[model samples]
Target: MTQPYEVFVQWKRGGAHEHAVTVTASDREMALTLAKRNVDVRGAPVSIWVTPRSEIAQTSADDPTLAPSIEREYRNVSWYARERQ
Candidate 1:
């Protein structure tokens, strides 16, 4: 049976992989091939990933449980970094 897969493409080395497109295929191999051809047809992507959609988990944007519950400034290190000359 075919399943829906999420495609992610990295356009440059050391860059984050962002969602590119979705494809339906019977297997992982086919999904990758389809994504490669259609997602970035004009140029080459540094890397590509095809994952079954059902395997992903995400929380709703409106969920309040992820909000910072308390002040945690002590844990932050941005101020400790040396300023560039």
Candidate 2:
């Protein structure tokens, strides 16, 4: 069967792989199974994402296409914010 889609995984709480990437699978069920297999191989995972390639929309490859001029201040947490006040 043709590869149906891509899978994104959240391996653990507070862990970072940054963001999405491509993976191939026959269907969502198979993709989830593959994700579990990958987690078994890695020995950890908190969540998984199985999205069809046809279902995804993304920017095309080009200079400044992925440029990050704007800061995502919300993505950061200061030490003070992490502590109980």
> Which of the numbered candidates is closest to the native, going by highest TM-score?
1
On a 0 to 1 TM-score scale, where does candidate 1 land against the true structure?
0.74
What is candidate 1's lDDT per residue for 9-82, written digit by digit as tens? 99999999999899999999999999988877757899999999999999999898877679765556754453
- TM-score per prediction, in order, is 0.74, 0.54
Q: What is the Å distance of residue 71 in model 2 from its true position?
A: 14
Model 2 ranges off by over 4 Å? 14-23, 63-85
Where is the poorest 10-residue window by lDDT in model 1? 76-85
Per-residue CA lDDT of model 2 for 1-85, tens digit only, reads 7476676667678675433445567778877776667555655667777778788787877858465679865555764576645
